[model samples]
Target: MKRTIRLAASIAGLAGTIVLAGPPTTIINFDTYPDGSAVQPTDAFTTQYSTVGVEFNGPGPSGNSCSISPPNHAYAKRIVASFVDPCTGVASVTSYAGTAQDSCWVPGEGIDMFAYDRDGNQIGHEFNAGGGHFTAFSFPQPVIARLDMYCILQGIDNLAFIAPVPVLRGDLNCDGAVTSSDVGPFVLALIDPSGYAGAFPSCDIRHADMNCDRRVDGLDIQGYIDAIFPP
Candidate 1:
């Protein structure tokens, strides 16, 4: 659960705090909507920040210091590192720009969050795991009522933590992966007929997708056979 705390942060002497860039909102605290799917609206957690308070507190950008203090009134999905404009409700963002500090994911990391208009045109994106937070993107010049969010996190152990929690959040078959192959075809059929390939509990072979194609097909079967062969 994304439980929020509001405790005063206990910082030891000489703790460095430097300005950084980022996003600062956490959402879907206790639901199964990693892609914000079926993400219901809850009370808004607002912070009055500005370009004046943009700062970072970690070894470097992309640092895993996601935390908040007085952890009661609200909670941050990860520690606040920085902000885009720091004043406006964020619309665009990035994380861990090139610097001396080496990236944990080699050439660097980009846990991307994509926002799109209803027409499926990308309006904005945030690198570095939504800038270690989330952005509020609106479609059609910020007037459209709906803007969809989808994300990809690399080297995020938090993803591992959330995986077993169940819910639609565990849908690894997203990205049409569940529909990338025969299994996807099956899901399409399930969506259409509801009693076809998925009629049997044992037939939900979505995971049978071995090529990351998100399907159960001849390729997957061949992959399985490949695994059994001598290297």
Candidate 2:
């Protein structure tokens, strides 16, 4: 049977927010398993990316490597999942970001944030142009979220990608547009108490964390309208 290495990330925050990723940074580098486990069904995952950074390098050297470019849906909040078969821990994996600019407009406006792992894949996102959201992720192993980064380009042709802005919370309903329906979950929780045992009555944060504060409250309810139809 093909064994499954469940690569994943541990988030610093929940729903609609960028989790704090700093200090105690980790870079995966290994030719063998720390436990002497046989090499996995995949290539070794290693990198120089510190805890301060998350996205792994692409198929080349630091000074020059190709990566996913912006304007693609991936840049706007899409998830990328890849599989690793050995079930061995992930020190790092390979992938790159913001290397192309065919439709370059806002130069230096790109970001890549790696999220948790689940079954056989390094599950996360590649914010090619700017920020978006991490959604529908499930973790099977301890994972670290990283802010994929790179050095500041020093020439006129040089560029530093601008990170993505997390998706607005009021779009909680995720109906392709924010609306009153987005407020339904929070209202149910706020208006009814006897139906839930979870911290928030709605249980699903994406629905209630309107302010993306990691909590549900009147402020979030207020956050809803403000974001859907902001001033």
Candidate 3:
């Protein structure tokens, strides 16, 4: 239930001044995805980025490990990789320099890492040096897009991503702004949450419940309109 407030013209004029902020920026932790696989090799990643083709030429039965979640696409400011190297029980990370392999690796020694941008250009490279290694790199700018990664490591686990802050509530289209464009989706969600979710999988449905009543109804719709129109 919601309480109704009636005010004189002077006070009502300020009603439209009420503004609701967008959703809080949050991190997109890849750990949400299960382990033992490489982020399902998304087409979005494959189409946008070149799989740098990590190669391991060590004598000690070398291999690589990588895992990411949401299985198909990633919308994050940056991706984080965590790993443990069996050979040294440590991790090594470095910037990639267009070399066939990470220069960090010597003749039959250590691990090499290579990171690439969407244009198949080497952007960064790093290797783990020791226990519970973690490193992150940001995109050219803050964006919601997919970035593919490959690693020739011993163990990979708990991969996560970082989502920027403050989601714009009512911007169901996620176009960075709220307008009439959101009305259709908002109505659809108010009537059918599942259907709406299916249509906009990336949208946080909670943001639609503008009244904070935990329910989507006519009142919420009116509240959304008020937030948009404002006194």
Candidate 1 lDDT over 88-201, as tens digits, reads 222223321211111223234344444333255655555543233323332223222122222133322221100011112112233322223344444443354345344444
Ranking by lDDT: 3, 2, 1
Q: How far is 45's C-alpha from truth in model 3 (Å)?
A: 23
* Top-scoring candidate (TM-score): 3
Span of 10 residues, lowest total lDDT, candidate 1: 160-169
The candidate with the higher TM-score, 2 or 3, is 3
Which candidate leads the pack in lDDT? 3
Off by over 4 Å in 2: 1-165, 192-203
Better of 1 and 2 by lDDT: 2
Query: Listing every candidate in turn, what is its Cα RMSD in Å to the true structure after a full C-alpha superposition?
Result: 19.3, 19.4, 18.7
Give the true-structure RMSD of model 2: 19.4
Candidate 3 deviation (Cα RMSD): 18.7
lDDT per residue, candidate 3, 48-155, as tens digits?
111111212111111222222222223222332322111111222222111112223233322234455434565555553333344444444433222233434323
- What is candidate 1's TM-score against the reference? 0.21
